[model samples]
Target: MDAGGEEAKQERHLVLAHKLFLLSHPDLDDLAKVALRSDALDAVKSDGMAPLFESLAAAGVLEPDDALLAEMRARIDEEVRKLDEKIADAEENLGESEVREAHLAKSLYFMRVGEKEKALEQLKVTEGKTVAVGQKMDLVFYTLQIGLFYMDFDLISKSIDKAKNLFEEGGDWERKNRLKVYEGLYFMATRNFKKAASLFLDSISTFTTYELFPYDTFVFYTVITSIITLDRVSLKQKVVDAPEILAVIGKVPHLSEFLNSLYNCQYKSFFVAFSGMTEQIKLDRYLQPHFRYYMREVRTVVYSQFLESYKSVTMEAMAAAFGVTVDFIDQELSRFIAAGKLHCKIDKVAGVLETNRPDARNAFYQATIKQGDFLLNRIQKLSRVIDL
Candidate 1:
C-alpha cells in the first residue's frame, strides 16, 4: 500500500478501536488491548492526539504514561506552530485559495488530533473562505465524520442537513450517494429502521463511503435494516435476489442463513441462525442499543409468517417446527398475542393456535364508521358554537 492507504488504514483501525472500547464483550477485551497498544496508539501518537490518549488512559483502556503524554503535547504544540506560520504566510503573500487551503489544513490537523470543538471551529473558518458548493459539502462530510466518531447525533443531524442544502445548490452524484449512506447510518443509530432501510437500499449498488465503513459492513447494515422494515416481496426483490448483496452476504457469519431461512420459511433454520448471530448483533456499537428490540422484531416476523399459512396449528407442531419445547412455544405465543404483535390466539386446552387476522374490508369499514362519527360530532359542536 501507498502512504495514503497506510494512513487511511491506521485511521480506520483507530475508529475500530474506539468501537471496541464501547463494546462490552469479554472475547474482544484482548483484541481491544492489542489495538490500543499497537495500531491505535501509533496513529494517536503520530497525530499527537493527547486528548484521545488521555481519554483512553482515564477509561483504563490504555495504560497511563506521563512521559508519553508530555511528548505528544509537545508534538501537538510544534505542529500547531508550523500550521499557524503556514496560514500567516499564505495570508501575507498568497491568494485566497492558498489562504483557504491553509485554514483547511489546520482544520484537518485538529480533526486528526481528536479535538472536536477546535476542528469544528476551524472548519467553519475554512467554510467562510470556501466558494464551491462541492468543496463546502466535503467540509460537511469531515464534520459528519467527527460526529460519527464521537457518536454525537446533534452534530451528525446538523451536518446532514448542511450537506443536503449544499446539494440543493448543486452537488455531484458520488457525494450524494455517500451522503445517503451517512444519513442511513444516522437513521439506523436513531432507531428509524424504515428510513434507514430506504436510504441503505438506495445506496447499495453505489456505495463508496469507505470512510464510514467497509463494503461488507455496509451490506450488513443494508440487510439488517431491510428485513424488519420491508415486506416479504420487497425483501426478496431488493436483498435476497440483488447481485450486490449476493456477492458479499456470505462474508458475514450466519447473516446469509438468517436472511435466507427467514424468507424461505424455514423456521428451525431461521431460529438457529438468529440465535447464532445474537453475539454479532450485540457486538455492534450501533446495533447493540436496539439488540433486544431487533430480536423481538425478528421473532414477530417469523411467527407472523408462519401463522399466515395456517388457520390453526397444534402447539406441538409449532414447537417442532421451531425445534423448541411446546411450553416455550406456548409462552412465546401468549406474550406476542397479549402484546398484539401476533394476529393469533392460543388455545391452551386444545393445544392449538387459531389465526384471527383482521379482515381488510371489515377493518376499512370500521375505520370509515369511526371517521363518520367523528365528523358528526365535529358538525354538532360547530352548530352549538354558532348558536352561542
Candidate 2:
C-alpha cells in the first residue's frame, strides 16, 4: 500500500469507530458531539462526507457548520485539480506504468474522500490499466474496504467474488490470507457464522489485516463464531489450545473464560462469562442484530452438551449442575425441548430428564439421506436438460 492508501485505510477505520461509538452511546449526546466535532469532523471534512455531515446535523448529533463545509469543499476541489493535472501530464509524456500510477492515485484520492461511486468508477479505470493479477487483487481489496466501511453487502459480496476470481489467476499468500479476513467479516456481518468461523480460524495464525481490526478483535470473532459452530472436540483443539488464540484471548475481557469455561464444562463460570460477553456483542454494529439468535444458539450448545452426558438425571441435579434453581432449569428445559433444539424429555412427575440422544450412525444415515435426495434432484434436472 502507498502512503495515500495507508492513510485512507486508517481514516476509514477511524470514521467507522466513531460512528460505532455514537451508536452504542446514544445517551451520551454531549460526549458524542464533542468527539464528533473535535476528533471526527476534520477527517469527515477531508473525506468530503457532506451527506454524513448533514445527517449528523439533522439528527442533532452535531451543529451545522457552514464554514467547515465550505473549507472541505475547497480543499477537495484543490486536491482533485492537482490529481487531474498529474494524470494529464502522465498520459501525455509518461510511460504506461506512470499513467497507471497516476490513475491509481486519483482512485485512492476518491477513496480517501469517501466518494463511493466516484471511487468505484476511478478504480475500474485503474483496473483497466493494470495487467498483473496482484495489482488487480489490490484494486479488489480497495473496493472491499469501501464496501465494508459503508456496510454495503451487495458491493462487499461482489468484491469478494472478484477477489477470488483474481486469486485464481494468481495471488500471493499474504493477499490470500487478507482476503480470508475480509470474507470472514462479510460472512459474520451477514449472519453466516459457520462460514465465518471457518474463514476466521484459517486466518488466525496468518492474520496481518490490521486495517480491518486488531489481533484481539480477530481472536474474539474466532472464539465467538467457533463456540456456536464448532463441536466441543474441534473447539478444544482449534480454539482452546491454539497458540495464536491463547496469546491474545485473555486481552479481551470475559472471552478467555467464555471459551475455556464451556470447554471445561464449568457451566456456572461459563454463564458468568457469557453474560459479560453479551454487552460487547450488543455494542457491535454487526453482532447487535444477531444478538437474540446468538443467545439462543449458545444456550442450545451448552444445554445439548450437558444432556449428552447421561441417559437420565434428576431435574434438581441438572439445575444444581448449572448453578440455577430447579424451576429455572425446568422452564428452560421445557422451552428447548418444545422447540426441538434439545432431544430430551422432562419427567415432571419424577423430576427427571430422559435423554433421547440419537446414535452417531443414525445421525450419519440421516445426513446421507438428505444429501442423496439433493443429488437426485440435481441429476433429474440434468436429465431433463439432456432430453431437451
Candidate 3:
C-alpha cells in the first residue's frame, strides 16, 4: 500500500480498536470514564473531599494542587467531622442511632456492589433503640442516609415511618420537612406517583431551613453540590440535563424502590418556584399532607388484609417485607376468625391447610371482599407509621 494510504488505514484501525474496547466492557467503559472525569471537579466543589481533589488532579481533570489544597481539605474535613458529630450526637440522645447504621451504609457505590447484611443489621439496632425528638430525628436521618446510600428497602420504609411519626408528633418542623425529602427519595426509588408527589411538597415547605440542616433527608444535596462546582468549567456540551439524571434515578434496580420513595418526596418541590404565577395559588399547602396521611393508612390496612395471602406466598419473603414478628402474624391469625376473615380446614388427602389455595377440587376463595375490608380496618391507622 502507498505510505499515505497505510497511514490513513492505521488511524482508522486505531479508532476501531478504541471503539471496541468501550463496547466490550458493559459497565464503566470509556464513555463512563469520560463522564466520570467531567464530573470529578464538580465533586471536589460540591463535596470538597481531599481524596476526591487529589484523585481528580491525578485524573487530569484539574491542575495539581499545593499546600492550599491541603489546607482546604483539612478545613473541609473538620467541617465534615463536625457534621458527623452533630449527627452522632442527635442519634446518641435517642440511643446512638447514627452509629447503629454507620457500618450499615457506607456510600452508594459500595452498596451497589452489594452488602445487604450490614444494612440489615443497622435496621435491627435502630429498632432496638428508643428516640426522642432531636435524637429520633438524628436516627431517622441516619436511616435515611444508609437507606438511600445503600438502597436498603427495609431501612427506607422504617425511616419513612419514623420521620412521619416525628412530624406528626410535632418534631422540629424544619427537620421533619427535611425528612420529607428522604421520604420523597423512597417514593422516587419506587416510582410510586402518589408518594413522590407528597414528598416533593414536603421538601418544598421545608426549604427555608434546608441549609441549616445537615441530614440524609436531602439525599441528593451531594449531587446538587457537586454539579454547582462544575459550573465554572469552560465546557458546555448538552451531554445530559438535570431531568435526565432524575429520570435515570428511578430505574436503577437495586435503588429503584428507594428512589421511588425519594421521587415521591421531591417531584413537586415548590420551594424552587412553582410556575411563577402570582395568582395560581398552591394546592399542596393544604391538600398534600392530609392526603399523604390518608394513603399511608390505606397501605398499612392493605398489608394487614393480605396477611393470609402473605403467609402463603413465602414465610421468608413475608418476613423480609413486613419488618415485624412473623409470630405476630401467626398470633394475628386468631384475630381474623373473630372478624370472620379467616377459615381453616383439614383436607384429608393432601394433609395441608392450603392457605395458598392451590387445590383445584376443594379450593375456594373463602374470604369475601367485605371480610378483607374488616381486617383492613384493623391496620388502617398506619399513617403514624409510614408516610405513603
Highest lDDT among the candidates is held by which one? 1
- RMSD (Å) per prediction: 3.5, 5.5, 22.6
Cα-based TM-score, every candidate: 0.90, 0.87, 0.30
- The true-versus-predicted C-alpha distance at residue 150 of model 3, in Å, is 1.8
Task: Score candidate 3 by TM-score against the native.
Answer: 0.30
- Worst 10-residue lDDT window for candidate 1 reads 1-10
**Per-residue lDDT over 47-138 for candidate 2, one digit per residue giving the tens place of the 0 to 100 score:** 68765667766776567988876777677789989999999999999999999999999999888776779989999999999999999998
Best by TM-score: 1
Cα lDDT tens digits, model 3, 242-319, are 343344333222233322322233212211222221111112111232344333332333333344443334433443
Which 10 successive residues of model 3 have the least lDDT summed?
Answer: 277-286
TM-score of 2: 0.87
Which pairs clash in the backbone of model 2?
A: none
Cα distance off (Å), candidate 3, residue 112: 15
Off by over 4 Å in 2: 1-11, 14-18, 24-38, 46-48, 362-388
